[model samples]
Target chain A: MSHMEFTGKTVRDAIAKACEELEVDEALLDVEVLEESARGFLGLVGHRNARVRVRKRDVLKEVLEVERPDSRYTNIKPQEFSEIESFSKSGLEDGKITQEGALSENIDKSEIVSQAKEFLEGILCRIPVEAAVEVSVVNGSIELEITGDRSGLLIGKRGQTLDALQYILNKSINRETPLEEKTEIIVDTEDYRRRKQEILRDMALRMSQKAKKSLMPAALNPMPANERRIIHMILSEDKEVYTKSYGEGPLRRIIVYPRKAMPNKRRRR
Target chain B: MKELVEFIAKSLVDYPDEVNVSEKETEIGLILELNVAQSDLGRIIGKHGRTAKAIRTVLNSASTKRKQKVSLEIIE
Candidate 1:
């Protein structure tokens, strides 16, 4: 079939129009954005609509692929999304944000920072450690950095203790709030978290490479929820490999399966 | 310690019959060696070694109160 073009005030509108014309669901349409809609000049002058090419998607190909390209958040009603709701990242590097600054203008940064700092200090004093909690707002998340001579003990084995502290801080801050109102809290100590992130990113790439070479799934060591998420995030885009976490909680681990190899996985054909 | 790891490994893997544990006295403490089926390695080790680390952490903590030093070696 030949490509058909559609135009509307914006890309989403154009896609909607195309779907209406074809009498097919939006997911079935393979859209290639030819030109993004422009508001142009003010809200009036030189304004132009978005134009896109459309075709039918291959159902079998779509199902066999490891990850959904970018179907999240499309169907959500605008009213359901709050101002502070975190942006769902579509492009890996670009993320989903149209803004480079703080998420919401109404959010009081100083108040939240102080509250987080106070909460952390309350716990630190109770422990035998001499660590000082340093709090600040970076991007949209509240970062709590603990510093001291004995701070290493706070890290615990594999940053489990640190992760627990961060989890508690996030839960306490977001206790009464709804889903969209939840804030991101990051707890760090002595550069350990940052270094671990780099190591995990590297391992994901290396293991994916191994999976591709050997046509076998490369299983990583069991990891905490947060750490597993990092690896999953990095490898989600790999076309040659498919990643999935196996086993149960605490022991849950990821296996990077090479795309072409068949393991007789049970499925309805 | 050997029995403790054995029970945990046997319960975690698909091939429970293949689970095995051995012990040896070392300078640092008592060493418990764990063995599991090749296919069940992922379940035992867990993502990024978090599962293994968790198992080791449990062993160390449990043995510490008894004034015993313990380490685990997982063989695939």
Candidate 2:
């Protein structure tokens, strides 16, 4: 993530400059107001400009490796498919398949898939982009994939656009469905979710090593809550370091600290 | 308090003139009912009601000074 500081007559002015220079919407950038402007002597002498630091929220550039073909699911044995099918069929007959029927008695997997597809189509129509949505159910999760020439636009920078779409879809679904029965809904384009996860896992490993070596905390750029959770999960089992999220609201960042640097006891007052 | 909700709703929606805010006093507190143009409903509520939550947060802070409880309702 590229961060820059800007000074202006007011905090809003500095944010405006950052947005203009970065060529991104104000809402997309994570902004920190460092200092408020000060006026003295009739707003002419002894005046200080407000300062702010702004950066793109998700700066995965350094961590993102060259795009590679996803092969995680390619190694499944052909003979196991029949066994899994029979297992699922029996599970469904017994009404023990929560993934397909958890949300609501009246709502089914096909209904959720169609509703998701329709929602995505509505967004695409507003964007005036031509694309075909392919829906698939894998292990009870609904996956909506957009495949077309203009699908790149939907992915946005570092898949932020796709994340926003998924967030909205999940929120709408949860609002309509009971909390205990809700299932995961993933929206993606060009296998972005899987690819991003691989990259994030790699980044987490590298950052933890750096934290251990330097004995100093390593703070990552702000990311969506789900991505932050991925980083936390990746390092949860490590004994040498621990991850903590800091900051407020949407600008929260994940920091990895060496275990040795942690304070062992609280100081008495 | 009603004017505050109205002002925020008007600023967020495209149809500012159609935004209407009404207050109802109840036994527990004040209820501010916000009505916006049908098309601009999403803008006021925001994605997953985050905007509405933010608006309520600000209203709570403002109401604290007057020692009154205020709740917001985005009426369809």
Q: Which numbered prediction scores highest in DockQ against the true structure?
A: 1
lDDT of 1 by residue, B1-76 (tens): 6665665565456797999888989898898888888998887786567567656754553464346888899986
Model 2 chain A poorest 10 in a row by lDDT: A66-75
Candidate 2, A30-61: lDDT as tens digits = 89888999986798998899998776765432
lDDT value, candidate 2, whole model = 0.69
For residues B8-59, could you state the per-residue lDDT of candidate 2 as single tens digits?
A: 5665667889999889999989998998899988876886576676566556
- Where model 2 places Cα greater than 4 Å from the true spot, the runs are A1-107, A262-269, B1-44, B47-76
Worst 10 residues of 2 chain B by lDDT: B57-66
Whole-model Cα lDDT of every candidate shown, in order: 0.68, 0.69
- Local error of candidate 2 at B6, Å? 23
Q: Judge candidate 1 at residue A155 and give its lDDT.
A: 70
Interface RMSD of 2: 13.1
Error of 1 at A200 (Å): 0.9
By summed lDDT, which 10 consecutive residues of candidate 1 chain A come out lowest? A82-91
TM-score of chain B of each: 0.92, 0.96
What is the docking quality class of candidate 1?
A: incorrect
